[model samples]
Target: MTTILVTGGTGTLGRLVTERLRADGHEVRVLSRRAQPYAVDLREGGAGLDAALEGVETVVHCASTQRGGDEQAAQNLIAAARRTGVAHLVYISIVGVDRVPLPYYRSKFAVERLIEESGLGWTVLRATQFHDLLVTLFQGLGKAPVMPLPAGVSDQPVEVAEVADRLNELALAAPAGRVTDMAGPEVRSLDSLARAYLRTTGRRRPVLNVPLFGKTYGAFRAGGHLAPDQAVGKVTFEEHLAHRFGR
Candidate 1:
């Protein structure tokens, strides 16, 4: 059995990856900020990481700081992976990191470059936003009677479990640089998504379309984060909501 270590193993996507890997009979070690069974903060480099990487053959990197500093954390992880002689480094990134001008996306793109030039076997998988994220966003906005959504913005939110399954597959295979992008089964406008969410949750909210003027919204409106050609996910947003809330 190949030993695998998953960074951010307690996170939403990371937790699913860890569970799938463990269920597949791989010896899985989870690295998290909390003091869990095999905890190691990627921001700090030390013996904890050394122990976490001990005899590990592959690492599925799912840890990320949504606020900032993702590049530094990735750098620390890369250094430790090199020291431990890891066989494969699998990184999960957003779909529009290169095209989007957001700070978080820029940080992810920088980390991708670092991994590509790290001289170690690596594979990067860029995926669309998760259904859970969309749900959370709609839930927050649904609290108001009139919800304002970004006009001309659309999303293809894939299921996290699908992304986790793909990560598991990539972890077991030989390193392949920049795999095909993953996306949800359908492309829906943010307005429609909000309406659907309201309908599903039994909320009566009028979605108001507000024009978003910014570089980030521009990229989103331009479909920078969309992979229409790579819509490989099978689950629909309605199905996801049904599963999530038993609607």
Candidate 2:
């Protein structure tokens, strides 16, 4: 049995991955800065890394700051993996990292590069935005009759569970360097999604399509945030919402 180490196991995706791996009967180790048997911050070298990765064959790295930080944190992981002679390293990244000018996206892009250049068996999965994110956005929309959204932008948001499943599969499979891009089955407008979600949850709100501005809006309007047509996932937004809300 391949013993795998999971960084950021406390996170939503990380926790899911850990649970799946454990259910599959694999030896799993979760690396968190706060836990008793955790590794320290990967930014600076520490003894905990050496201890955590001992006898681990594979690593699913979910440890990352959404906001960009010094690139050394990723570099440190690479260095630790190499030093420990670990076999495979897998990373989860965003779909539109290259197109999105956000700092977090830039940092993810850089981390992908570090993984690529590390010369270890590696697989990188770029996934679209999660459907849950829309729920978070709608929470702030208040009890208004109309939910406003950036008009003309498109998204192919996937269920976070689906993304986690793919990650688990890749973690067990041979490294493919980069896997097929993953995304939701449907392509829908931001306004339409918000509208549908409101109706789905019985929010009784109409969707107001507001005019978008600047490069971010333009990029999204051009479908830069979506995956290509060939890589549609099985889970749909309707099904995800239904499962989530117990509807």
Top model by lDDT, which number?
1
Please list all clashing residue pairs in model 2, or write none if there are none.
none
TM-score of each: 0.98, 0.91
The runs of at least 3 residues in candidate 1 whose Cα sits more than 4 Å from the true structure, single-residue gaps closed, are: none
List model 1 lDDT by residue over 106-146, tens digit each. Answer: 99999999999998899999999999999999888878879
Distance from true location, Cα of 129 in model 2, Å: 1.1
- lDDT per prediction? 0.92, 0.83
Lowest lDDT 10-mer window, candidate 1? Answer: 35-44
* Candidate number achieving the greatest TM-score relative to the actual structure: 1
Q: After superposition, how far is residue 1 of candidate 1 from its true place, in Å?
A: 0.1
List pairs with backbone clashes in candidate 1. none
TM-score of structure candidate 1: 0.98
Runs in model 2 with CA error above 4 Å? 143-146
